[model samples]
Target chain A: MIRRRFALSPALLMSLALAGLLIVVVLDLPPQPGLAGPVAQAMDQAGVGHPVTAVLLNFRGYDTFLELAVLMLAVLSIWSLGRRDPIPARPVQGPVMHGTLRHLIPVAVVTGGYLVWVGSSDSGGAFQGGAVLGAAGVMLMLSLPREMPMPPALLQRLGLSLGVFAFLAVGTAGLLAGHGFMGYPPAWAYHLILGIELAAAVSIALTLVLLFLGGRSRKVRHDR
Target chain B: MTVDVISPQIYLLCGVLLFVLGLHALVVRRHLLLKILAVNIMGSGVFMLLLGVAARGEGGIDPVPHALVITGIVVAVSATAVALVLMLKVKAATGLARLPLSGPED
Candidate 1:
């Protein structure tokens, strides 16, 4: 009887070789020296104290606006494909999970709120805050029975679109004021950035939950 | 002599390896879900690489690239979510998790 030989696929071998070569080349390169840019000057003009947030929401607001639009577009396309029913009812969880969830959810909410507020001054920002809130939503969904009622569809839709709408409205206002689109006056910059971040956090959180749900549902049902 | 193990080159090398692995998986994997995951891994690699580059700047890490990577992360997540949804729809319609090797029948 002839036996078949097992060997690595040619493609896999080639890829591994390439990766090894890449590592060699990358290591040989000298350490890169830091380059100075307009960040220092821009930081002074940026409304927020956090340099990264200032760049995201002020210096490159246009990019952030488009990013939010892209997120909204993703949700729209998912919804258009078809509605998916919420997860089916599951057996009741033990008291341990129930107790944990009850405590966990409030902490998550407070932490998320703190992140959003702290974003103006430090490393935290809207996205981090939004992610925290989204996690909370996911946790709630898991803890509650499938039969639990969700918020009204209209409210859900508004939440999904809030970021994009807020972004556009602000940008358009800038255009009307002759500062170019998404451009903000120095005096109003801080307030405008904060407002936009607030709206964006809400939209991001809701959109994330909707994405996890996979599609729209007319109403969520409670398992009990 | 102490060699810095946590240098930017190490991070860059890791990113490169991850990117190649993802690319290989993308090319070889037949399952739609696996392909989607591979794409996400590739995206993460790019993010890592960008962050590594950002670390090289003089006074401190560049805020610009850090901001860009943060934006990229959200975009990547949104794109992945959409891709997963589309894959599910495809599965629902055809009852197949993997795409056909040949083009669709005319």
Candidate 2:
């Protein structure tokens, strides 16, 4: 019988050793003191009790706006590639999947709404809410038959662009009021942030689902 | 040496480990899908590092990094989607999942 080498490969061992060293260096670094910066001052003016949301939507609203634009750009790039052949639909989902979706989708919608609402004062926010909605959309896509037509293109496009459009409108209004771009008046900040979050949640959900679907809208198969 | 592995340092170490693992996978893997997954893993590692640092900050976790990480997550997802679409386009055009390696003659 031929004897085989059992030791780890040199390259793999080297990589692991390097990683271990890097980890040690990182672990040895001294912890830096927290710099809340202007967060405390902005928090009261932000109109949201959750510090993270306040930071994301108010103090750093410009970042969020740009992030939405980035998402839109990604969708546009995917669309420009034209459509690919759709993955063949599963022959049929089991009764368990169909039943679970029937119950789960409604719960997801309610939970998503609650997440957005509670974001003002707690841990949840637009992204979390949007993800929940997106997950529901994915479930629907997987469970529903391929013959079921997708929503109209126009409606889908509207949903995709809604978040960035709302953000731009708000920002432009702020500029007109001499508050500078993305700066809402302190008194109106709460309502404005809420409006933006709602629109963003919708846009995010639609965009995420589209990303998962890939390329263009799927064509409904005539063979049932 | 006494090591408090349960502390934030451990999380930071984990992030570093993940980053290295992803980097290694990207270097070693020939399949486009694996590369994409490796890139995502790298992105997650960066996010983990950011959160770990945020957790270590005095007076509750810093909201600034948390907000930044949220933005990062969204950006990473968008980037990944674009990458996957590009990969699909490449595969469609060339009928090959992996790109051809550069030759010495070239």
Candidate 3:
């Protein structure tokens, strides 16, 4: 299989040109206040701590939780697809591509880990990193030509559950932290965030890995 | 001198391009998976434009859009899953991947 990067020659030109024009428009236009200024301001007024993180977890957490469930449903849907069909023929050639994927898979896993580690401070996050890692797994699967690439159903389940389980389990840790229902007490805030991020990373990777598996039908054996 | 500036219309165009690309993919692609990918590519493009507009905020990135994108991402995947499952069932019944024929093979 070809390396997965999209060669956005025209897309690059278009995006840049559009971005440039927007620069001019934003300059001509008026400015507006931040959307969450009121809520954040109230937090400051009331002496609530770490309002940014608080807003992310408690105030707007229902959306986040639902997002996690959506990922779960994606996995389940893919899993069900596999059950209905026997398996897809691994028509993809493996021996030729094996060398390249073996080298790349570890690199992807590492990159994914780093993304999760620094997501809070940087652009990388569990979703991005996990997707990257999942790409590596897909690469590996593509390279292996279907003799026996997939791990057992149990492992698949673990991969699917890793993120939601991690996020919710830690969110529940709030009870122990004395912060009640999705609240992270001040003292363990860092640890809790870190844990949630790590778990999310695993979850996202698993989700991406499984996304490709979604509409695949059963493998048909053909005599050459 | 002052810093350089970007126009909001660029943001609008970005959203337009993304939506158009998605539309094109929906029309042109034969593969079930490729169409889904196109849909996501379109989503990312529109989302990028939205984020660009959000950049107009004073503090930094607008959390509201960020949150929305986060929400969108989840919803997108959920829809994707349902679509894929439907596709698979179609494939199982028909033995052919090309749609408009998700029916069973005789």
Q: Each candidate: RMSD to true structure? A: 3.2, 3.2, 8.2
Model 1 TM = 0.90
Q: Where does candidate 2 chain A have its weakest 10-residue lDDT segment?
A: A1-10
- Cα error, residue A180 of model 1, in Å, equals 1.9
Instruction: State iRMS for model 2.
Output: 1.7
Q: Identify the leading candidate in terms of lDDT.
A: 2
Candidate 3 segments exceeding 4 Å error:
A1-30, A36-59, A81-96, A175-180, A215-224, B1-4, B20-42, B91-106
Better of 2 and 3 by lDDT: 2
**lDDT (tens digit, per residue) of candidate 1 on A10-75:** 868988998998888766766555433677767877878988888899889999999999889888
Score candidate 1 by DockQ. Answer: 0.65
Candidate 3 lDDT by residue in tens digits, A1-224: 45446665565556556656655564466667666576555443222244444444455655666677788877676666564332355555556566777678888889988877666555666676777887887676555654344566678778778777776776677657676666666656666666766777777777776676553333553323
Structural similarity to truth (TM-score) of each candidate: 0.90, 0.90, 0.69
